[model samples]
Target chain A: MSLLRLALANLFASWLTSVVNVLLLALGTASIAILLLANAQLSSALSRNAAGIDLVIGAKGSPLQLVLAGVYHADVPPGNISSAEIERWQGHPRIASAIPLSLGDSFRGFRVIGTVPAFASLYDAQIADGRIWRRPFEAVIGSRMAAVTGLAVGDSFAGVHGLSDDGERHEESRYQIVGVFESTNTVLDGLIVTSTESVWLMHSRHAAESAPHQDGVASHDHEAVQHDHEAKAHAHEAKQQERDQGQLHNSVIRHGDDITLLLIEFSSPIAALTLPREINAETNLQAASPPYEITRLLQIVGVGLNWLNAFAGSLVIGAALSIFAALYASLRARRHDLAVMRCLGATRGELFNLLFVEGLLLTIAGIGVGLAFAHGGIELLSVWWGKGQAISVSGWIWAESEYVLVFGLLLAGAVAAMLPAWQAYSADVARTLSAP
Target chain B: MTAEKNRVLQVEDLEFHYDQPLINIAKFDVARHECVGLIGPSGCGKTTFIHLIAGLLQPIRGHIQINGVDLSQLSERETDRLRGRYMGVVFQRLHLIPSVSVIDNLLLAQRFSRTKVDRSYAVNLLEELGIAALKEKKPSQLSQGQAQRVAIARSLAHRPALVVADEPTSALDDGNAADAMRLMRTLTAHADAGLVIVTHDQRVRREVDRVVNLGDVA
Candidate 1:
């Protein structure tokens, strides 16, 4: 016989309306919750993967492609830049460090990257066992790569000839897994790291075998082989329009001494302003700032995100209206009940509490179910997504803005119920009782 | 003056109006344990008169008293408390919450009276009314006579000082009306509560101890 008990009974008495309102509110809340969590985690991972490197120096092409491929290993590298030219930039006063990424091959679906031991420092990477590659053809597998490929330390595997999974296998020089990089939750977790020499040796021998029967004879001098290899690689690339990108890529695996891109760090903030401009303008290679390209990418992507956010916001507004309509119609129908309660000695304030509490229950049930559904869905997606390998987005991270969303919607529910509650509060008992 | 001391409800120079005056009374009183019937034709403001006595409507002039407290002297909040604690009303159409059971309707009145919920007394009332088996049944499920009996139970559940019933027998056939009149009188007498029956039905005359004609307002 408590007012709350009475209110609860009233709410459940109209179970169909109550259920529909809860679902509408839940849909809106879940939509916004998913968007907020996805955006926050995606932005975090993107920024984390692109940490440290100020600029990416590569063959002249799209800066975004260079940044994506170079920093994230997510796309195709435009082509290659000469190591001698990169070495010259390494000596520049503004350039603090230069890490060369010599890309060309893959084992299973993961890329096998040829980089110096110092490349590990960019991510603060640690080797979990054994050691970094000491000799040519030795490799350190990333933790995720190790888990996926099931490659153990001291194991060897021959790589395919392209950046992708389906490529011509190169059996002449197999890479031995010398160590495993500890999980860093970055793009590095999906790559296999080795000395630049291993890539050079593999491609030169593969190219020698492609032109006839020159596979058995080994070349000892990197400088000599690179000089001869680039001449033929460029000649094949010039006619690349005749064939597809993947075939042309496999055909041009000529020199590992010529790297795909140079990851550059500036000595100071002034170097960031001056160095990329100098590198892009003064040389054949293009130097793209990772942060700049990432910002531009997000700006283009943000338009879509904003539209989706607006769509979700409209759902929230629609839900508020739904709850209002349900409550208003219910109170109008229950006017007699309101008058009866008044006649039974219930005060105006008590009547208001009764209706307001009804609104509050609907709002809370909707928000609670919506948040639970949103977070639960993301947790499941994370499992499936971790294996798919783009960037790691966790459901465990909660955005501060979701708290605001919940509070704001609760206030909206209160506003929606306000007029009807007031009508009930001001109901005339004598007139209501006499009405037929 | 001695009768005034025993009065459960007293009205003096009560005047209320909407455009033209709807209710005008010089004086009326229902002493303790009395059963008074106020008889009038339709639209004679019988319902309005009972509302004024129940403190649901404030008189434009003069005042009404319930349990010897001047209703006009009490705050609106206090008036509501007074109505819950000292006054009981049964309308032509019952106001039992259709969502809850018949027994729950009685408990609702008891709860609003700010009294401890007495479930045993509510069961006893239903028992006295011969609807104890229907205590858990919703109002919508009951027959009209059963529903009326539930309404009577609601009004007197809190043992109020005065009970006002509006057209309680108007909707019933003669047999049901007789049974309803008999129940209201006996129940109020058992609680030592004064009763006011407002009706257009002349058939209620023999059941009442006194009769007041509302058609004599002029």
Candidate 2:
């Protein structure tokens, strides 16, 4: 009925070539879209989780690992620092708030963080059920942890000694589940929180039980011959008393001193410039800036993503070339048909527009299919990775760059069809119409 | 005087050249409902003469007036528009877009001519041509005779004042050629339009009312 309809009909008549062009373009567009969505989500998740906390102070080791362990909880902590050292910096004039974290235990793959109530407030997490931990052995679980482990109020579970589930279990220290925190859509949602005293209690009891035993002789009220045995027993008792005193000393040291890292915020911007330097210079602790370390991590990841984007871009160019080749070749075969149209009184411009419309229709359909593929890919990624890390991958996230990409693809299609359309417009109608 | 006013085409001092002169016609004219045949040997510019009259080629020197409007004075776009509205061409090769159905091909003619498509009129025309049942069939599916009939139906779909057939029956057998010529002449007369058949087919030459030899004119 119309030129557009005629164009559509012709495309469908050559459905195989059209489908191949659309699929190639769709695949390229989907890959670029997936990359953009994933990169944006990764950057935002990193920034959101690292909010409020400006610096992390831990044992001198890999600064990146320290940030990863202390802030993101994605890796093992560098090492432990003494609580006395943390307390010494806690009251500094430049410090706004400092919360000490004691790590090294887990419940069902989720890290059990030993910190105070302020840690929960750092993530804006509230008690969704019951209450926060009120005692040394009571635990408050994160929303994700609670849902995954099915641990509710008044439930009790034993903690494993390390970050992984296969670590040694402390059967003696059973922690009662006191509360569950609401989902913060951050790393906080995958944590089991308790007081630092609880971690100290569990490890100290294990240490005391594993201590070396002193040899002893049994004494009886016999005679002077049993005096040697009595002397050995008295000696053993003295050794035992010394061992108990040493154990008490060790318990006191462990209970008051050990913590994994310090999550710190500055009262003023001046502290950011001075505190990390001062702490690293004056003390054995290593000061790591979360923002600097996270930026470095993303820069490293961005290189690989850039390569993938370039690959997808090349694929788009290839698809455009294919479209051009197909249309140009088809034009050669349809010369007589074009001539017939001319004889029917179609102008050169109308013939050119028909090809242009055909190319545009293919590109638009391909883009639509490609967008659907991108959203489906993101949804799959959310299910596979987001749940474990408490990252939300839901919602439509359209980027301005994608609009630019759509325009570029449409332009590419137009350019591809330009030559063939021109040929169709300038076809020698008289010669073609007279051909046998 | 009324008959002179009904003249569909008039040509005077028409001369066209491509490398050399292909056509030099002193005078030609066709009145309404008139049927004329243009006969020529092979390579004698029979098709070239048709192209010149159809506004597809500009004459080196000529005045071609269709319905008394001089084509040489019109712009290229206006000439195309005039041709779309006032002229129909049936090519030697019977060119129908192989992708579309017969009815759509006819509709396409109206579309290109910027005229309102009357489906019932197309159906009536096809039925009169005895190929109404093949309206939905693609050109490739139709027989050669059916394809040629479809081409004729498309050309006349907009009811042009003049229908030009360039070797319309050259590919047919003797019997089929005579039938095609008869059908084209009858259809053009029924539509109240003049017909011009440029061909070397003797059977077609006998079917028209008048014959002009291109070799003699050149």
Candidate 3:
């Protein structure tokens, strides 16, 4: 048998030892893989969601926190900017659209985002299932919220108090789920979307409870008119009057002049470049170009990842050292075997060959098994998490970095085995042979 | 005969020690094509002498030359090369490699040795040693006699100038030991190599050209 085959056979003979060695390597590599994969996806998602928007005008705060809260809808908006103040910028010469955001509530940790239809357009969001919100108090749900809440078209539900369950209640204003949006694979998927007026009205209900449940009555009347065609003629004029009363109260309380953030799109590159500095100086508000801010965020995260990767690499080196020890320890036990081979005219190099081959074979086998296990684990995680969402979780395991990790782990194993191979080469054949 | 052609091993003023003081030897030599038996009781330095001859242990004060190359003057690399190319060994325990098959054990001999092997000759040697059928078996699978035959076959696989079989028949039964001795002698004779078999077994003492007893040496 060839030295490699012989070494492999030896490794196979001690199945438990080899498995433990391989498993350690696999665990170390896989943990590193998951950390890297998750970070890359986070970075990718950030860049993808921030693609169309040129700049964000938000209340002065941490720029990264603002991006997380404003564009992603993943966190609470930093603070409110007067909607009236935002409206002044809506029709500016350089402005394309000013999407105002109103946020104060959540459904099961998912933020309920109150915004105009420009919110959808800004992220290239489409309604793959039903339609976008057209009326106040009628909500269009994001893909993840739709899947998690199991809310279909026309299903009505009330939002929980605040982002958490313990916040003060808004019992006066209940919402009807008008549509379920398709998966966008963006942070928008983790939200409930409604018009800015509806969000204000919900808060208004909290402020003035006894003020003639105006919008609630209008929506109830609208639903009733849908069932009976004969009542349609009678209800049409009544519905209009109710709608007018609802709007009059909402406008009086409509803090739409105060917005948490403004996602700005520009028709020209020059306008986009000059707008941030102009807005930053013009008012107390801050403007951030998302791509630049995101790049900076990634740089901070990248340093952490490099240190983590080095840690993982060092653990792998430790595993290699363990393999070296296992082989070295096995050498004395194999002395009789060596001596016999020497008597048969086996040279020192051949003895070394046997040991080296054994080390390499053990490493290769462990790496192969570990990589396969890691790949399968990643695939399983993706499939489980991908249910009812546009976000593909399977991309993590198949990424370029995963391939590099596998190659790197195998290389480390080879280098580990070389030390003991040299020791076996210079072994004292006569003494070892005669040892009892 | 040419000066290089007749000499297999030459030793002069060989001395060695363990925890004790040194035992000096004035001169000793073995010619090519000779089978010499080193007979001595326990702790009498026969194995130590063979170790020196095999280039495994160096003498405190002497030189050992195998074929024409003086091992004392050789570097570790050259010593290793000489050992690989010119010497073969059979331990008292017949230290057969346990992991490989008997055939692979034979093949391993060529890995370090300078001598080119003939597989057919190896097969013939195994056949002569009555281990041809057991060539694919591991050392652990063979009987003591069979394993020793494999060891002898391995030593002769490279056709080295000297074969030092230390206490070669020590572990075998009387019948098996006799068989081992006869087989080793026949094989080394056919290979035309010098054979130094170190053992205290007086039963097989008559088969060698000369019996040097370490008990009577000093």
DockQ, all models = 0.68, 0.65, 0.30
Rank order by DockQ, top first? 1, 2, 3
Best by lDDT: 1
Query: Which runs of model 3 end up more than 4 angstroms from their true locations?
Result: A52-54, A58-66, A75-212, A215-261, A265-325, A336-368, A389-391, A395-435, B2-6, B12-33, B60-63, B114-124, B214-218
Candidate 1 Cα deviation (angstroms), residue A265: 4.1
lDDT of 1 by residue, A85-160 (tens): 6568778899898888888788886888887877888888999988887666778988888887678898999998
Clash-forming residue pairs, model 2? A83-A257
Which model, 1 or 2, shows the larger lDDT?
A: 1
Question: What DockQ score does model 3 reach against the true complex?
Answer: 0.30
Best by TM-score: 2
Q: Return the candidate ranking by lDDT, descending.
A: 1, 2, 3
**How does each model score on lDDT?**
0.83, 0.82, 0.71
Best by DockQ: 1
lDDT of 1 by residue, B1-218 (tens): 77778899988888889889878888888988899999877877888888787778888998798989999999888989999998888978887899889999999999988888999999999999999999999888999999999999999999999999989998899999999999999999998899999987888999999999975643
TM-score of each: 0.86, 0.87, 0.69
Candidate 2 residue spans exceeding 4 A from truth: A84-95, A211-255, A268-271, A381-386, A389-400, A434-436
- lDDT of model 3 at position B175: 87
lDDT for position B195 in model 3? 89
Candidate 2 per-residue lDDT, tens place, A188-294, comes to 98888887766665555544444333122211111111111233233333444454343222112222436788899899999989998998898888999999998
- CAPRI-style docking class of model 2 based on DockQ: medium
